[model samples]
Target: MTTLVTDTGHPVITAWSAVSPYGIGRDAYAAGLRERRGTVTGLGPEHGTTPDGVGCVVPGFGVREVLGKKGTRSMDRVTGLAVTAVGALLDDAERNRAVGTGEGAAFTLGTTTGSAQSMMDFTRDSLTGEQPFFVDPARFPNTVMNCAAGQSAIWYQLKGPNATIAGGRAAGLHALNYARRLLGSGRARTVLCGAAEEFSPARAWLEHRCLDGTDSADSAEGAVPPLGEGCAMLLVEPRAPEDAGQPVLAEILAVELGVVLDGADPRPALVTCLRSALHRAGATPADVAAVARSGAPGRAGGAETEAVHEVLGTAGPADLTPAPLIGDTGAAAAAFQAAALLAFAADRPQQAAGRIGVITSVDRTGSVGCALLRLR
Candidate 1:
């Protein structure tokens, strides 16, 4: 296992995150964390207003700004979020590199709905209006699963292996694991790894099918996920103690992924995944300082996670449903959790040693993934 540290003398988290409901930056995120405030609120009709009052929307930067004017015309909303996030991560690395160049940067992106909006838009247009022959061919490329990863590499001039994975909620954690493996196998000098999800009207509709949308339901009491949107990126390197912009927040100790069939509880596989990750990291449940759970502020996911904690007997130190504040950013959920854990460690460095922050994700397809992280 490797213990990564940032340049600021904290454990090496290297390059980390940026997330918000209102285009707020890292400082704002820190403030929200400190205040325990929820970023979710009702977006007015100026944007895409929903019948339901709650939403997590990005405040600033539109598609045109995130992707260039020409690029924006061809990209979907989710692609826009991914490009912006990956750009921020690469920029962070460029500004803080103590040793190597950015040419060797690798990328692994995760997402559940890569271009659902695009598909929905095209379908609606076809049914409502005359057939349009002038459809832009460039836009078609962005509809594929790997489009975000490909676009990010093209934008940043990265020449390393590019990968995309999606197994519902496990997507982000799985992507991180892929990047970690690349570094460990000496395949790349550095990696840009993360996930991004875009909120769509369809998502809310899907939730209605699985959950009851009522005022009385606590955020966690809803039957389905409270879908939201955001992006998070991490820069991983093989070497430790590089002169990066920030101190090390934590190291990537271990990662594990497991598959369970539909209707299976997944608790067993999840527990095994966690135990395997801890064992690989040479740690135990007691070594974990906090658990950054990918709970969606809904009952099914939360109950399953709670059951896992019960089995492990380690629920007290973990933070439950932190995503309710920012909303569930699809593929970015686990990556966001990873970033949050690192930031939390950085703020409380004295208490971070030997304390591993565990990130867990369970996909609707019954796949489970766990990542074990610790400060150096």
Candidate 2:
């Protein structure tokens, strides 16, 4: 059954900000996506020159300019990405004084893993240092995955519940669910939520080791998208007729999450999540105007796309794989897809009005998540 929501229970996105391979800010993101440009590149000798050195990274992202040199000294790349995006979101929201930074406001985010580079560096220091105490004390905080979420709250003066979830590709959906729950339950009126991943030496090695790190996972059928890093954040709050802070990018009609049993095929789980999310949102596949699919190479991607086509038929050229433009963004992939879709809806109001779309995130481990959104 779909989770029932009231006028105040429905979550609507008021503002969004993104730091992608395209650069900082949603304009850069939309331009990159619209132009079909990707930032994936081969690693240079500094990062270990190997044939497998291909991935997407945010270009010219400087924490010194954004957060200043002193405050960013202890921050890791992933945290830096998150904080930058949050600052941008607040900046946009402040244009109308929409930033409600009190206990009624919350901060939540998802990540593939903590700061990969930080964990690697600190662990190396401990293992090879003259003593355990030789490790840099300031570097310890970034080792926790929650650092980004916590830092956003601290940096932005957001005094509310802060949460961080780790779900790889599915983390964005998880953060959405958590934010929605908080809004529906009256725990927080407005929630800033999103996901982020960092492109670093450690992450690059992990990508190569997986063997599925190619820019395209299915070159035989279509282009293999690049793996990317960056952060995307959205401001969500319960909805009402008078709640017109920012023309809502979209409404979170329904959200569903499912998991495949260990060793079981994920196809069925993916299908169930899609159907369930649509049903809960009071939408049929026919009502879905677009879809953004997130999965690895092979059947994972095929399964999600095929299931949507089977249930809803064709959304035509609007069906998109963001990997080509932004790369596989790990935890941030689903959120990025939603941001892309939001940009799409905003640009093509005639096409998006009265139509709904769905964003699906299927993790390699088994979790399948879907969010049904209607443009407003």
Those runs of model 2 whose alpha carbons end farther than 4 Å from true positions after fitting are 1-7, 44-51, 95-97, 212-224, 244-246, 315-317
- TM-scores for every predicted model: 0.85, 0.92
**lDDT, each prediction:** 0.68, 0.78
The most accurate candidate by lDDT is 2
lDDT, candidate 1, 1-376, per-residue tens: 3333322211235666665564634555556665777767666654463447567777764778656697567777777887787665555555434322345567888887576767666666556665665455567776687888888778777777789987567788888878877766656667778888877676555544544344226554443335678777777765453445444556777788888876576677787888788788888777877777777434447545764586457544557345767776666788778877876776777666658888887755677888888864
TM match of model 2 to true structure: 0.92
What tens digits encode model 2's per-residue C-alpha lDDT throughout 14-58?
888899988899888888877887687775664544335776777
